[model samples]
Target: MSVRAHIIHAVTTSVSVKLMRGQLAYLRSKGVDLTVLSSPGEELVAVATQEGVSYKEIAMQREISPIRDLISLCRLIVFFAQKKPLLTNVGTPKAGFLCGIAAWMTRVPNRIYTLRGLRLETSTGLKRAILLLTEKIACAVAHKVICVSPSLQARAVSEGLVPLQKTIVLAGGSSNGVDTSRFATANIEKHTDLLQRHNIPPDAQVIGFVGRLTKDKGIVELVEAYQALKNEFPHVYLLLVGNYENGDPIPDEVKTVIKRDTGIILSGFVRDVVPYYTIMDVFVIPSYREGFCNVAIEAAAAGKPVITTNATGAVDTVLDGVTGYIVPVKSSEETRKAIRTLLCNPELGKEMGQAGRRRALNEFASPVIWDALYQLYGELINRR
Candidate 1:
């Protein structure tokens, strides 16, 4: 039998695909067996199938479901046992923890838990404790722990979540780098029809946000800032590309209010986000926290300026006042100022956007990240 590896996760959103896309292609090129296991609701199954990679759906909920959790855990244990994968890789917090637990129980040869951001960062009280415990459990189970960001890796060790000796962070800590060649400004030519179909005019200044629409993502703050600046900038437009699941942290009232606003256009979720980036004059991620702001990098790679919070992963992506401004999280005043500054100064935006593209090519290119993962996989397999 060929050597098989399993990449497990919850919702296989754009992010899941972005992080694993290059790695999957590389694995296939090497004739390594690649199987992705994710929650039942994801579009990953279909996409992976088309790529000739296998997928298995497991019971998963974005939020806690006590009874269902038990059933899911049992099913995962059996699946791991049956597959006996040469390697087991888990992602996202809940999925990481559950898969880590199952991998440990089955004594999988090479177990990896790739921790992105701590979901517990924004939690409180007893709930926070539970989240922390789960993280520890997941870290303990993995033979090797993967922390996507240096800041997060430091936090993990300091917080007593993962041992210093067992964890590794690769290439400045993005889950994976952007496909620079694909996201280039030239590629936008292919997306001309996408813009027409979306009813977006050729000349509108599209300010876009891509991620789960939630409180933690600072959707409310984004709206307030956009509301404050819209009337002043007549050609300005807002595009929101994401879904609003019940499991999301955003308050119902906030979601209702934002969706009803005529100024903002919700595209729900699109498969190929490269076109959207091409149409956008500026890409904004006013998120309160992030593992690594891949969108900011992608935006920069697409030759669009970015505005994000001065938080963990974001700081690495943006060059303050150069590539874009890094403002205080949850502060509408700062968010608006940054956005307006970019709009009023198009040349600066273009310059910064160009700088970001160079930076991405040097530091966050797909090959740079793929080589790192390929080497890591080789090391782990060799050790076994």
Candidate 2:
């Protein structure tokens, strides 16, 4: 089949690029010529190369810097001019804003900005003001503004980031849906070797958190909750699976607190998070905020109950009590209560996990997501 269109996705880091590989592969199979461009790194380059997608490394920085940002803008404009992609999809507020501005400058036909989350939520003063302007411009210059969550879409509309008519949410709403088939608990038996390798007892009540161990993620509350519950549930093991990088880093205070808990295991950045999910009984993510916790879905798919904060993106995943419990943001007592409830009632946890798996399969298979995305792309490409 003739390659129907050329599409470009711009992201600031490899993490987004890596996470979207499956999505990209799906698009490629449908006859789209896909090119991914972003900052130079092992994370971005390796995936792009492995997937046989074209990639260009643009010099983009997260921090505010007028001079460096100017050079980065020039580089992006150059890339836009040369590639002239049919649709340019920009991710991350910084790169998205730059891509929008550069696409406008280069007059690319379709400029798309994926509004994952607002970085300004955690900032203050001049920095926050700058981020606000950046998000506004990203929405303004794009032909389409897409929010990954309904809450984000509503916020963007209320803030006038994008005209309400121009914004849309892909899928039922997630950057991409979790692969329930691969992440399912049926593979739990196969992961016994992983359990032995990690030295976790096969029968251990595995309590886990998977993401950057940062203050914003409420890692402090997680440490405190673990400390409070570990004594009561001695068989419970806390597994942390992520490596802090760039904008997200673990606070020293959080580190000091976790050091006091010996049952907690830190496995920095595993390639296959599925095995970890296979071994977990309960998943916890008390994030102060979240674009969306993909791990929560993965855990639910693996027939494991989840306990997460009532933050926008995350709260939607856990159906209160049906799938898992949603605790207050940054509240150790609430998180502890949720954990204790799950640990105390293994049958309830199993039932919730089963409910979660059914929900994911019914609502969020990858094909369902890709169809929505492709329809949106077709609409944008065909629109005047």
Strongest candidate by lDDT: 2
Give a tens-digit lDDT track for model 2, residues 145-188: 88887777877788677888888877777777877668644665
lDDT for 52 (candidate 1)? 70
| Candidate 1 lDDT, 233-351, residue by residue in tens | 87788889888766546777777767687658888887778887877888899887778888888888888889998776666788887888889988989899988988898898889
Model 2 misplaced regions, further than 4 Å:
1-3, 184-186, 244-253
What local lDDT score does residue 216 receive in model 2, on the 0 to 100 scale?
Answer: 83
How many clashes does each candidate structure show, in the order listed?
0, 0
lDDT of each: 0.78, 0.81
Candidate 2 is scored at a TM of 0.93
RMSD of 2: 2.2
The prediction achieving the highest TM-score against the true structure is 2
